[model samples]
Target chain A: MGLRRIDVCGLPPPEPLERVVEALTTLESDDALVVVIHREPVLLYSLLARHRFHWETTLRDDGVFEVRIERRP
Target chain B: MTPGPGLSLTQAPPLSVPFRFYLGAPLFALLAALLLVVQGPDALASRWMPEALAVTHLFALGFVTQVMVGSLMQMLPVVAGAPVPRPQLVAALVHVPLALGALLLPTFFLTHWPWTLYAAIGTLGFSLAVFLFAITTSLLRASAGFPTVGGMWLATVSLGFAAGLGLLLAPMHAGLVSVVVGVRHLHPVWGLAGWVGLLVVGVSFQVVPMFQLTPPYPRVVLRFFVPVLFATLIVGSLLDTSPMEPYVWSLLGGEFFAFAALTTYLQQRRRRKTRDPSLGFWRTALLSLAVCSLLGVFRPFVGLGNTARVDTALVILFLMGFAGSLNLGMLLKIVPFLCWFHLQATFLGRGPVPHMGMFLGDRAGRRLLRVHQTALFLLAVSLLWAPAHRLAWSAVAVDAVWLGTLLVLATLRYRRAVRALAAAST
Candidate 1:
């Protein structure tokens, strides 16, 4: 399984959301996308679930938000 | 394929539900300014004047509270991950009674019509009870530890206390029961400092970062300060009822100062590379908050001028300057963001989608913020020179109209964009 990572920490809002959506569309079934952001993308959680992407998010002690997503079977 | 049971966090209410409330809020602001225009300087003379009561409630119930209801409905599911059941029905039910009651109560205050007051009580009370119960139930079901979520709980409790006191006052106003004059202070104390204040603080924790591109508030402050603020308000309320307190007011003043200072610090530390129109509103608001807190410190000692005038000025500073400015700032950001978001959701991968930055005209936003600042400046002048009150109200009316026009334009553009994308899709 390949792990793809994207860091959107310094990017503006819609950019981060757009990049993640793009990544999801092109991602392979075995691959998981890891998104590192400066703050929690609260809106994305709903969108991901609606699109049937199982995801996990945790805020690191370093104060960055990390979200992992993969297509659900 | 439909996902069952656990998809509650993913449920987004129809955008129309929140948009309806947003649209109502500006119209209420228009009503408030026009009411002030009709009432003239008398509205600014004493907080007890019938016109004063009307205008105050109009802003509190109709505008400020209206926006809060809409924002909470939008945020509860998306931000807190707690979905309201039948959000559209709930919005419809609350909006009707709340709007009508807000209008009628002020009219009753001005006219002293018993039936009007009674109807106002019924509708306003029902809406508050339903709203509080609905929101609180959903918030409680969410699992814990987000400071934003915790702030909502405290603010909700404060709303209950504030609403109860406000309702009880109606009977006293109607001569049904004798009420304590000192206890009357509890209504605004919990309502403004408790309900409005905590809610703002809670939302700020999330918003400053998202919209302002600020860093997260210090974790310790987030975890502890909101509850601390709640404790101070509760104690302050208790002391108002007690005769033996020497420092009750001062203690509350201290907490407010700390809050104001912390918020100012947060604003200063924001990392956004470009300046936005909303920042002007926010900076003015933070400055007003800091000034209000300092004024509170010396208010008891200032051996001041007319008591009624002083009280009115405090209200203006706290409500319009601090709270209202922040509300407008968020509206500028959120309204455009939502318009873009809902329209974007309908976009099929056909034509190039419009950028979020273009959703709201930057020049138009800057102009409205200028109008708002002009209104605030005029209000401050009105506080000092009574003759300027009419001009202040006019400025406010213009500001409201400007904002309403912008919101309407954006909504239209959003609709047109959605239709174009739909046609292109097939």
Candidate 2:
């Protein structure tokens, strides 16, 4: 499986949302996108579900949120 | 991984829920400005003047509270993940009476109409009761551990006290209840410092870092500051008739000063390095807050005999300078963002979506900021120079019109974008 990583740690709202949405458009069926962000992207979860993607969010020791996203089987 | 708490994007209220309040707020501001223009210097001459009270409520209830209620409805769901129950119905219940009460209360003040006062009491009482209940329920339900949530809790409590005290005072003024001198002073304190101040602090803790890309406020400050301030307000209110009043004012002033200083420091450290007009508004707001804090701390020692002019100056600085400036700045960011956000949701990748900047450009924001600053400056000058009142009133009127026009234009632009998206989708 291919892997893409995007860091949106400091970008404002909707920008982070926009970038993630854009990345998903180019995401392959077998690819996973990893996003590093400043806060838990609560709003992104519903969008991911709507688009048939599954995500796992982890809070790093450094207080950043990392969301791993992939297409649902 | 633990699931995010207190936030559900799906629960976000319909855009109209907040927009109506936003649109309504500017009209009240315009009305206040017009009243000032009509009443001239006499209206501003004393805080006790009926015209002054009318204008104050127009801004306080009509503009400030109107915007705040709408914002809380929007923010509670998004930030706290606790959506207001039956948002559309609650919003209507809150908004209609609030708008009515805001108008009626001011009318009562201006005309001394018994019916207007009684009607205002009923409407405002009902409106605030509903709002406080709805917001308090949502806050209790929110599972978020964010410091902002705690701030919201305290601020809501403060609103209860402020609204309750205000309701009591209105009846007392009409000889329905015996006047309590301490209650008279406590009402504005609870409203401005407790309700308005705490909410501003809380919202800033989230937005400053989120929007400006600044470092988050120190965790210690975030956790302790709001609650401590709330406690101080309670203590100060109780001690209003005591010799300790000056000390309490000094402490309160210090707290506000620290917040203003901290915010300014964070903004200076913001990573964006871009020319943001919102920054100008924020800076002006912080500066006003800082100045007010200093005045509070030093007034007793400086022996600036509490003249009507001095009292008016402090009120203007707090109301127009600090709260008004901050509100305008936030509106500039929020309106465009909401327009963009809703449009994006509607389009759902079927077509191109307009950027936030397109709805309200930076140039327009900067122009409005300049006019607002001019108005603030003229307002200050008018207090000292009697003849400058005309110029000040004109500036305020222009500022009000400019703000209202900008918001309307932004909404119109949002509609156009929505139409374009629909056409493309079809």
- Top-DockQ candidate index: 2
Q: Evaluated with lDDT, which candidate comes out highest?
A: 2
Off by over 4 Å in 2: A1-3, A25-32, A49-54, A70-73, B2-10
Task: Please give fnat for model 1.
Answer: 0.12
Q: Per-residue CA lDDT of candidate 1, range A1-73, in tens?
A: 8899999987766678878866776778789999999866767765676656778777799999888887777
True contacts kept of each: 0.12, 0.28
Instruction: Tell how far residue B60 is off in model 1, in angstroms.
Output: 0.6
**B279-387 in candidate 2: lDDT tens per residue?**
8999999999998888877766777875566667767788889999988898887788788777755665667788889988899999999999999999888888978
Per residue, candidate 1 scores C-alpha lDDT tens digits across B80-193 of: 777777898898888889999989999898899999999999999999988998898799776545688988989999999999999889888887888777657778778887
Cα misplacement distance, residue A38 of candidate 2 (Å): 2.0
Kindly report, for each predicted structure in the order presented, the TM-score of its chain A compared with the true chain A: 0.93, 0.96
